[model samples]
Every structure is written in C-alpha cells, then in structure tokens.
Target: EYRLTNPPKPPATVEVMDGENRKHTLQVQVLGAEETWHTPSLLLASVGSSGGKVVFSQIRTLDPTEDVKQYGSTLNRNKICDIAFYQKVHLEVDPGQYESEETKFQALQKSDKARLEILQDLLSSHLGLSVAEKQGPLPAYTPGYFLGRHELKLDFLSALQPRLKADNILKLNLLSLQFCGKGVEPSKPTASLMPVFLHACPQRFSTVEYFENLHSEHIGRLLIFSEVMTSSMEGLDGAVLHHGLAVVACQQISGAGRSGNAWLSPEGCGMFSLQLHIRSDSYLGHHVPFLQHVVSLAVVLAICSQAGHEDVDLHLKWPNDIYVGDCIKVGGLVVKTIVDNTMTVCNIGVGMNLDNNVPTTCINALLRELKLAPLSLEKFLALVFTKLEKLLVTLEKGSSGVDQVRQLYYKYWLHSNCEVTVIGPQGSKQEVTILGIDDFGFLQVLAKDGCAFSVHPDGNSFDMLRGLIAPKVK
Candidate 1:
C-alpha cells in the first residue's frame, strides 16, 4: 500500500500518464464523512479510502450480485467491505453526470470495473504528486465519525436511523452531503453547520430566532427543529400549531406523500411544511387548490432566480411538482388542507434537491453545469419567502388573481403538448397528447382519435414521452 500524508489543498487535480501513455486525471477532495469514487474510464474500477487514506478499492457494482448477500456475512470481514467504512474523501468528480440520484444510479448499473493495472497506475500517479506537494510535517486530521457499509458509529445517528428508514430513506445523502449535519442554531449560516433551506429569512437574520420579527406575521409563527424525528410538518401538526408554523427538519423519519404513499425523508433535501389556518371566509381558503400551484411556482422562481436565469426551463406538473430542465424532479409541494374549528388549515409542504445530497436535483450542480455559482441556501430561502408572499397576495385577489396564477403556472407546465402514455389501473396503455391544464389544474389530454379528457391525480398515470424513469437506488 502507498502511504501519502499531508496532501496539498483539497480537490487537487492530477493527471497520470503511464508507460503506455494512457492518461487519467483524478480530482481528490477531503469530504467531511463521505468516501466517494467516480470516474469515466473502464480501466480504473475504483480505489478505496479509509482512515483518511486512499487504498486499492474494488468497485461497487450497482446490480446486486452474490457479493451483496455475502456483504452481510463473510464478505463483510473482507478487504472490500473493510474499505466500505472510510474517512472523508472524494477520489473523482464528473460533474457532467449530474442529475437526481435515481438517474445517475441507472448509469452505475451498466458500469464495469477497469483492469487492476489501470486503477493502480491511476492511484500512484495522483498520490505521488499529492505527497510531493506537501513536504512538511503531517497534521492531525481525523474524522469525528465514520460510516461502514452495513454499520455506522455515531451517537446522534443511531437514534434517528429507525425513523429515517421507515420513510424509505435507505441511503442518507445518497448522492451528496446535505442534511449531513445537525442543524444551524439560531445563528448565522455555515456551509456545513447550518440549515441551508431556511438559513436566513427575508428579514436578513441568519438564525432560527432570526425569523422572529416575522413571527408577528401569519406565515411565521414557530420554526421548530428536532435532533431526531419523523418530519417537520408532522412535528408541527403534532404540536397542534394554532398560531401557524413552519417546521424545518434536518432529517425526517417518516414522510407523507400523495395518495397515501410514503415519501422519502432525505437528510440533505429541503423538507419542511408551512401550516396556515385559512378561515372559511378568508381569501386563501377560497383558493386552496390554486395555493398549491402558487407554492410550487414560488419554489421554481426561487431556484430560477438563484441560478440568475429566468429561462432555466423549470416546470410545474400541475397540483404540485417542480421539474428542472427535462429530466429531474428537483422538488415538489404537498398541500393538505384541514378544517380546524371554523378555519381551514393549509399544510403546504415544500421539498427540494438542495446540495450534493441530491446531485441531479442539486441547484448548485445544475448551475455549475451552466457555468454559474450556486446561490446560498440561506439566500434561496429568503428569496422563496419573498416570492411566496407576493404569490399569496395575488391568489387572495379572488378570480382574476387566480387566473393570473394559473397562467403563470401554465407558462411553465412540463406536460403541455407532450406525448404521454396513460396507464390505467388495469395495465392498459393509451398514448395521448397533452393539450394543456384545465382551469382547475387537471391535465387535459387528447387521444389519437381526437378525444379530449381531463386527467386528475389518481390511480391512472401517464408516462411522459420526454423523460426516462430510471429505477431508484436502494
């Protein structure tokens, strides 16, 4: 094994040219607690990382093989499994393969390992320069925590894993490292220590208590946080938020989804629910359905503005979805309204792929691909709040305002004029062309025979001919 200490600055890029002149460039970075290896070459299968050291790693095949079963037993004690638990480090980065975890995971499935010689050369070339760059004393750099393939050792995580697993978050920060820490205190935002979603408010405050002045407003009642729990919304609902509340959570144990489906509570994704009690005669209660559209639009606008581009191709899937570009379901909203006393409580939950956690949906990665810097999570939240306030005011105008909101949403509708195959409950498939969305938000789809029908959110679903549905990573 090659031991190289005191490496140069993080994300040090090095290219290896061997006897055959086969060249490969490796970008080395020191992660907080995630060990990741990525490359485009078939020769270098993978390299291992542990104790803050890079070792010879056997590539992890996406398809479950015999080794997967063995990973839990004898193989767990083997060298491959040993490398599974490593320190903070990143071996390679291909920003081009950026997308949601699901899309990239599909690419991983077809990957084949490189020859041992290629991987060895790739390591020796990069590591040799890493050592050469630092000719001084070694530093006491160590990780506070470590993660194994099947096991993890962390005081705070043990108490939270059960609940996270219950919500189908099998892999926390599966792609990137958001939701990778506890949350920010009622203080300024730190990249690794703060809650990116609501770091700062429109008030310019950078802490939990920062949303204080807004506490006087109907939108800002209480911003609750949990060291371990199910969800931010659930937490608020549990407390019976009478004054209205926006509960933010770093990790969600059990998440709710549409049609009684369980939503995945990922650590890094922005997961929160805003509950506002809209009275029967209130402006918002009369337009509850349109409120969902406004929230979704608000999130899209927030992200688009952050990208410094209004033409980022973000779209609404009617009801509540924020689709980025053409392939990724970046984030979405789940609106559940209830009658509490004589008021209608609108529980508007918003989520998104924020950072490295959801690479595909990560706003930063998307911007990076477009050659732009990422907008800080704190600023992003502040922008969202600002836009949301305006949207709510427009929706409260009754009919005309509602029509304007619909038009805005329609301008970004993802399925309009697209070919889609609707699959009925009986597994029957019929191809149709989406004309547009109805005034009520249901999809207006046209069949080949020229029959137009309104498709509501239900058991029957249509597959858009535009994007591919890759199987999700476990």
Candidate 2:
C-alpha cells in the first residue's frame, strides 16, 4: 500500500567551484511515516562532469541489500545494480548562472525610482507649490504646504477642515497668509494701503452696532458695505485710507430694503447686494436685477449638467429663483452691480444648500427626495466660475450678447405657459397669462384686459409680483 509523507525541505544554497576543489553541501529534513517498512536502499550517481569523467558517491541505505553484484545491470536482476537509473544523471549548471536575470531585476528597480521622481516633479510644478515631507505616527505619504496670496475665510475653513483631516494621506493643514510684498514696511503716519473689500448686513446689525462690532484688529483697511445706508450719507465716500488699506461702507439709499451687503475696494471693484426672501406667506418683488442674476445662475447649471455622466434636469423659476421640481426653490443667485462713471462691476453670489433639505419649500429638499448625493461646495464654486466666465465673455460683445443670455433663459424657464399674477404699483394685482421673456430679459405677460405689458422692463418689476400673498391661478 502506498502512503504519503511530507517531502524534505529543500536546500537553502547550492554552489559549485572549480574542478579540483569543488564543494557541495546539502541540508534537508524529512518527516518519515510512523509505520515500519522493509529495508530501504539509496543509490547515488553523477555523470557528465567538467572533464567527462563519471563520478559516483558511495551508496547509503537504512539496510544493506543482500543482492548487489556490479555497477551496471539490466532491470529485474536484483543481484546486479542497473546503470539505467544512473547513466544519464547529468547535473546541469544552475539556471541563474548568467547575470541576465539579476541585471533585469536591478533595471526594473531603477526604472520605478525614476518614474516616481518624474511624477513628484510634475505634481509640484503643476500646483505651483512645494510639499514638505512629514515623519510621525501619521501616514508616511501625507504632504503639506503653505498657501500664499489667498487667506482662508472663516466659512471656507470651517467646511474644509473636517474633510482634510479625514483623508489619511494628508497630515498637515494648509496655512494661508496675506499678500504682503517681500520685506517689512517701516512705520509711517502718512503711508496708506489700498482696501480689498468687506461684507456686512444691516438687518443683522444696526449701523452703530455694526461699526462697534467690527473686529478692528483684523478689519484691515478695506471695508465692505451692506444695507445700512441712509440719505444723510449721499455724495460722501466712507473710505478711509490708512496704513496700506482702505476702509469703506455703503451709502444707505432711501427705500432700499434692510438686508444685503456690499464689497468695496479702492481699485474701483464694488459689489452691491440684492436679497430675495420667500416664505409660505410672501413672495416679494420680481425685480429686473433679480432676473439677470437668475440668467447668470442658469448658465452655471447648464455647465454642471454637461459635466456629469447623466444629464441633470435643472430649470429656473421666473424673476430670481432656481427650481428643480413642483414650486421648490433649490438654489439662489444674488447679483450686486456697482456702476460708476467708468465701468459696471457685478459681483454675483451663489448659495446652494447642497446637503440640507427644506421640506416645505427648497431646492435642496427636492434633491434629497430624489436620493442623490449632495453637491460639494468646492466643486460647485469651481463650476460656477467656469460658467460665469463664459457668460461674461459673451456679454461683452454688446446687444448680441444680451440676446444670447435671453435665449438660454427662455429655454430653461419652467412655467412659461402658466398664468402668472403681476402685482402692480400700490397694491394693484393683475393676473396675466405668461407669454415669454422679451429681448430685454423682461417677463412679457398678457393681461386679462388684452393688454401685453412687460412686467419687469429693466428687471425691477418682479419685486411687485413677488410681494403678492396668494398664488394666482389661471
């Protein structure tokens, strides 16, 4: 009966020297079967030596064979040892005797090192930043850097901190510093710096309280203006040039609402705020600026749709809001245009409640209902800029530019066929059938009296329409 036993462990090293002083050492361990067997015999033979001379080692066996005649014999002759078993026992040279295999392995290692260095150089050059290597209990591959030119705003840092920490490969947080040219400046009473910008809201704080709460130490010179202006400040520029910065605020105009803010800089970059508040009880003015703002927003939505593998169904509500479903507001865009004698600069603020759901009336709430992952603020901001840049370039060409924006707006407006109620001046409510938006980006509504009046000629008429308390149906 045949029985299985564990094979002997192979030798660790095998080497051969020159012909005269060649040495061979074999170390092997075998676990034999427990059962007692008949006497076992072992035979050893070597052929094809360097000089073609046969070399044989003495046979060793657990028990001596009684029938052993000569070195060569035919099979079935127990008395004579057969040469067939040992005739062709030629020991071949080790397969790895040549240096080709070692050479290939070394070459592969060198190539891998070179490839990694190239990738690291490319990454550093593309980011225009240097990464500092870190050593600690943290991940070995984490890279860290200090950010220049741009400081992290409070809101941005709050949202980004957690995500960066969660990535096991990122060890250190990015540090941001202000753009101060090389070398420290000398203290001087008259030296002043140009302001960058500021943002504040009056409804959130009164003018006196706002100024008092300004964290003066961090305020720098640039001041942002919001809804705290009155007629008393007319023709008076509130900017104060001090220590390489400018401090400025808005001129509170009469009839302007209590919310919204402005950004001011000495470089002539100014932005105003237009806030839209909609609740279950009220939808205020369908303003002209608001429509233009919504058009800018739609351009962003179009780009996002193209980027995703599946097309997202995105559309706009008349006047100033974006909606994805039955009367649900998903996102909003605020446009503050500062027009001076020289130029008009519009600062567009887009706020999207990516993950939050407002069940009663919000676009974010609808997104949750569809079971889609919330959009990240960083990705959304990047896409918005890309889309805005394209739209602004197109708009610079004149009236033709406006026409293109109008076309895109009309294509995305969801309720163009529904009856829309227009609230005219002084509490007058006019229910008109929706026709379409005109070239000037105005809502062309056909009144019940057979008159077609442009609801928002310059974009301000929507304010009246939005103020009505009840939804007007056809």
What's the distance in Å from true for residue 466, model 1? Answer: 7.5
lDDT value for candidate 2?
0.36
Query: Model 1 residue 18 lDDT?
Result: 38
Segments of candidate 1 deviating more than 4 angstroms = 1-205, 208-217, 238-240, 260-267, 282-287, 311-313, 357-359, 370-373, 423-431, 447-451, 466-474
Top-TM-score candidate index: 1
Off by over 4 Å in 2: 1-291, 294-304, 307-311, 358-374, 397-401, 457-474
Output the TM-score of candidate 1: 0.50
TM-score of 2: 0.37
Cα lDDT of model 1 by residue, 128-171, tens digit:
42223323432221111111112222432364455443222222
Number of backbone collisions per candidate: 12, 23
